[model samples]
Target: MPDERTHARAQIRGVKETAEADLLAKKNVIGVDIADKVTDGKNTGQLSIVVFVEDKQPTSKLSAADRVPKEIDGVPTDVQQMTVELQGPSMQLVDDVTPQVDTTTYAVLHGGISMGPLRSVYLTPPDVTSAGYYIFAGTLGAMVRDRGNGATMALTNFHVACVNSTWSVGDRMVQPSLLDGGSSSNQFGSLTRATLSDDVDGSVVTVDTGRSTTPSVQDIGDVAGHTAATVGAAVRKRGRTTELTYGTVISTDFTVTINYGSDVGSRTLHHQIRVQTDTSRSARFSDHGDSGSVVMDNNRMVVGLLFAGSSDGQWTFANPIQSVLDELNVDLMVAPVVTRPIVSCLNTRLVVCNITRPVACLFTRSAGCNLTRTASCLVTRAVACNVTRATWCPVVTRTAVTCSVFTRAGCDIPIPDPGPIEGGQSEDGHGYGATADVPEEYWAGYLAALEEINELDGPDEA
Candidate 1:
């Protein structure tokens, strides 16, 4: 699919262009917990920092001995506290070490995990800083669809659809310039309500909305009509933050390391091949202001999702548009409207689903399914299936299931697995947060806490 206009053009083309692709191979980490998104549709590009209770500790003044951790009177225990910082208006990049203040008093005991003021916090929004633990840094692009039929799904990078793990399909999104802080600017984008992919170890949940007029996607430069390069094609991203960052496609297909909560994960991914450029159609590779920006080809069709990148902005990656489109049951590359026929879990097919349900349940796909030999089926029909490529798990709505096979290809009925996947929690990297299954008691305190946060933050302004 290499397009002519997107043929590799480089400022220093002679130097790094020929370097063979290098894979990170393993995750660079010890371990850390990070959440997905939060949102309130406005174009001003304001993001809230979801600092964990642990990271909110006042590191400024610590006692030698770990004090009994409890708050007295109306004060919060250091463990129950977090700092809230905002980027000033005009999106100025704040480069200071986000000061961890001592919100605790002498009455409250404090201290737990000692996180550096540096690495963990997005000192400023995407334009100036990032905590490096954001969601899209991992998972492939995301899809939002209705809760009923899995058919009406729309695809975009998780960062685009979500901000801090709070995405509700049908919600409007916007980008605004602030004369002052916290004011919603005039620019706005309307997002249709669709299901969200489950959390790190979960599946997808369909979100249904009755709203009409979903925006037709336009490539960064409307590059869809353009031809796609095989491997060495140069790619660029035009997003909400880091407006435009240029980088070469390192590889056509490769495995990328993603850190999702406790585990280090790798997904088979593809890129059009790009490198950072000083000027990408007059936009910086990425600035703090852009989060959901779309990457495009020379002809301007979308190729990648502009999600995460570093400060110097050397390496930036998208949830290759191609992969997500296939998983979410959407179409990629418009003209031909090519689709890999859905694999049926008939005889000899292996499937995996995140959770289990009867044939009637919605959104749960029987994945890693092997039909013929699966414990569930004897298969009356034979289908052409490929085992060579490690298949991706299917996106289903609100259902919890492990992979199971059916009697035939494309069969909706759940047949037992020839080779059942190990656990029922998650088979794919996509995280499914089933609010339905979760007991209210578990997060009741969190809800209560947010109520207080609303009171303190003075009811989040639109």
Candidate 2:
């Protein structure tokens, strides 16, 4: 069912070899390729010989016959200039000025693997007071593994994590971010390697084995793995700034010029994937602080790493996740489930209920509870949890009171409980005291009774 124009293009594609040789024979013609004929920014479905030239109008003393071709093999030709240049990290260009310190709570370890935004960290060359630390804000990106030895590493933009080539390998990387008062106590990893290629802007930080870490991301859950990106693929992401969002890949093998803000000059990047936001779906592809977030496909496969974008949110760019992994010589760290002690409880009917492993409870009420995944039982209460993927495992709640639970980064549920109240007046004007004398052995039965009453009142009654 090919149209006339499509047939013509197919014909042109077959005979383009002869056209390319003839075009290259002409002066100033550097390269040639078969291309679609575009008019008014739309492809007409017709093919042409795209001729590359040094100059459209050469001022040198050359004969008229030596000029670039206007047509080849009776097909139209386009004379275009394509000069590519590569630049290193932006901090290298703007190191003369004092960097502004951004003290914000990005990410820091509270339990095991904690994910968050990255505020600027201060680093200086040895014995140089005049030197300034690289300062900027971006997401932590994701966790990856060393290809050679299977060691885990942290991933992010070369500019964001390495301060645009300002820091050296073995330099300290902290969390809660220095802007948020990070110090030696907050050190999470160290710079191990990095790459700034025509196709990528990335760095790898070797995770400190002494610290607790997880490969899971916030809201989006664990990254199953990575794959090559293709046009029209549905994609999603989670970052410190933008918790979770999704869009579709509109273009691939894209080349673009990106601005690095005020002090840093612009640079060109090639072979990028372009994602367009669907405002109707309230989609957001990227933002200023979202750089380094891993972009995943609808299948939960990692596709790209978000780096740059238009300020208006119309378009965004990402290096192929496969390319990033290859460039860094590492593989993605599969998300791991949290391990906790086994805990159980009794429902309102006095029947012992065995809470499953890897379950998270966002909230608990008298009548029901919000679990990370749906659990079915013949009890009188309802248990609800958001299920995104099937890999969710059991973990303990951040606030472990009685037998309640909470989801981890690899699970699809929100943290549901508030901190335990100490000696204070209850909302109902009942005063609670630590010194209140109650029979110790009766505590378990009393708590079960209290929970029954709470469930009967439901979550809203709180």
Candidate 3:
């Protein structure tokens, strides 16, 4: 009586149950998940199971690829590389040299919602009293609505919301964090779910009905929508520490082990989007208090939830948006559309000065505006560029030469010609134009675009 999709899912579950122990016992194999097969950027519409394998390089003599099986219980299986460490609940120490923000100032600027990145703090008795309270701060990822009941919830990292998995359900989470002068009055939500697994390192807090909250991310504006991330997509985020920062997707499906200090040791996270810092901005994309910040693509769609970063802040990681939505059983609140102010350029064409926030321009391939090169757009007497929402370029080229910030780190001033510019400009809330070395900052994003373009052109061009 079940549809093929449902039947395949069920069969895959059975295969996992039967082979989980043996499969996990194999080298590098840690976990399993079910998903549809994607071929040539299109979903095959056929269900398949995913097997998780760990380590920097997944390979083995016992099995074909690290002992991973191509099929389980007659269902096709795919392997995902991940990192596993032995980290427990503990606050990450903030480095003095790392770029930091003043919590009190930003909290006052945003209002209602307590916002800041890192500081010292407490979690109270049951969660942890040994060190009094754990001192930590992470970005409040976003406000999500439960799929079943439509109840609003606060999304953040397990380390941010659950005290590194120490806190249980019903435990209160405070904003400005305890270390930033947060107390009972600032309690925003209670832990409803926590996941420290192969798929995610996150938790959801059921926000108290009485508290003031919005589905909007500070500085960057509203959550226009949600989408899965692809390598090379230009993304941005507003966090407690950095306020607003930008970066490029280096790898969408990546795995790495994280060292969570001595007591917590380390833990492996699977299916993560690895992002490198925008060289044009501060060298680091995020700092101590950035964990739990929700990353949005150029089109303002939720892409992933930030969790960890390297000491230098150059490298950062996140759980894919789809995985978070599924695991939490929640949906992002879609921001409403609003008309934006337009400016007339040289009295010949009307140009939308700021189409990146609050309202998105939907004119793709409209009259006089059909430039859709990777991360770049051009329009004359038009509403929007022909570029897709997932595009890395947000720049709009016009005869008037007024350039707006694109979503990717490499996006910069509009060039007269349509040939792809070497690199993008930097967006750190500063009006920086593209430099000759812009490509260096956006090498990762540009490389991905080049690969795609090369594939389209075929073997001769390659």
Candidate 4:
């Protein structure tokens, strides 16, 4: 069944690739991709090439050259009306006198939290404000590890981490972002790598020393791994602004043009994933501040890294997770699972056996001897005279007996002892032998061990 679906998807992808360029050239058209065919506002469960347009107009209103074809290369085509743009937020001033505190101010970092590069901009008279500079913020998507150096890192959008072409490696990146009231003291990491290419607009940041991170996404659970996006698959995401939202994959293999404001201009991203708010839910899938959030399927397998969305957020776009990871040369930081060895025993007639069982009993031996004497009266009578010299003889005999018995009580059961505490109590005041916060220097060692365990045993099925 899965193979058949893959083959059908591939056929649709070929048709999309062939017609994408020509479709994108049409007026009002913004993107093209493969998606489920929608008829009368209902999904038909049929694969088709989808063309996204800025506006939906009647046939008479659009020129013949601008009209989208009903079908292309024998594959059906669907025109979806929407406008797309990069999801990064614009710079804004800090207007409130009282400081605001939230997850953005979190000392420990994780995914689905606000963060951004520190940038300062001046506003003129029209935007009157006492604040001297402006700030912009976006979501911190996920935790990642560098494939080459194994350094702990965080994932986000290039526009969120870099902002402009002036960005360089080692530029400051902060938690809660400056826009979220995060200042220099909140600085957690620095930008390490970034790519704004035909397929990805992603970046990585170095997690600084003394800081710690977990693989779990806020409001969601841990990410197991990544998988390819499929049309009609239910998905969800957690972001800085939206917090948590449910959606569905409306299209895959998308190529869309996104406007990154005046600084980065417009960029064409290919092989993107398009998601729309689930019909059962009323909330938007993403917003301006949600850029860089990772999108996960129902099973918690990441499908994409969100970077763009429509103005109203009814529709959003993301770079395929595999492409993002490949471009960054990194892997997702997954949670480690605790495991214990399995013990088994076998029993035979009069014997109990176990490879790992401890010895049960100790064996010892003791011996004693007794003496006995016998006399020959008959012979003594015949040689009375001569036997006067015959004296009594003494004989001694020694005997020993051994026995063996086996019982269930004779077998020893081993009991495991808990190891000594290392960092004292956990956050909940329980002595779990581990600290709630681990030092940043130890993260590399821990991550290495986690990688080894994952390779040997794979992730926990539960």
TM-score of each: 0.32, 0.50, 0.50, 0.68
Candidate with top lDDT is 4
In order of listing, the candidates' clash counts read: 104, 14, 22, 0
Which digits, one per residue and each the tens of the lDDT, describe model 2 over residues 1-462? Answer: 336645665666555555555555666554454555555567675567665554555536657666655566687766555432212122211244332223343343221122222333344443224455544445677878799978778888776666543457887776644433445566777888887786788888887886666666666666777788866678877754554777888555455554443233455565577777766664566665567778888766788887876555766778888889889999887755568644333222332122222222235433234433322111112122222112232222222222234343454544454344222222343223221233333434544664674465433210
Order of candidates by lDDT, top first? 4, 3, 2, 1
Against the reference, the lDDT scores of all candidates come to 0.31, 0.56, 0.58, 0.72
Worst 10-residue lDDT window, candidate 3 = 354-363
Model 3 segments more than 4 A misplaced: 1-133, 259-265, 338-462
TM-score of 4: 0.68
Task: Estimate the TM-score for candidate 2.
Answer: 0.50
- Candidate 1 per-residue lDDT, tens place, 1-462, comes to 234312322211222222112112211211111111123322222111111222333444544333323322222211212221111011222332221211111111011100010111132333335433321111112233433454433334443334323445445322122211112231123444322232111112222244222222322322243233334456665432333345565433222223221121222222322334445444445543333344565555555544444334444444455444444444432333457756454534322222222122123345664443222111111111222212343333433334342345656655433332222222333212222333435435533543454455342211
Listed per candidate, the RMSD to the true structure in angstroms reads: 31.8, 19.0, 22.4, 21.4
Query: Model 3 over residues 28-106: C-alpha lDDT tens digits?
Result: 6655556556555576766666565655243544556346666765788666555433222224333223223534522
TM-score of 1: 0.32
Candidate 1 residue-wise lDDT at 83: 20
User: In candidate 2, how many Å is residue 218 off?
Assistant: 1.0
**Segments of candidate 2 deviating more than 4 angstroms:** 1-134, 180-184, 259-267, 336-462
Tens-place lDDT per residue, model 4, 1-462, is 757767888988877887788888899888887777888999997888888888988889999999988988788889889878677754576553222223447766788889987655544443333535556788899999999999999999998888767789999888888777777888889899999999999999999987989887888999888899987799999998877899988777879987664556778889888898874774788877788999998888899999988877688899999999999999999888668543222212111011111112222222332211111000011100111111231111212111122223434433233332122222344222222243433534533543554455432221
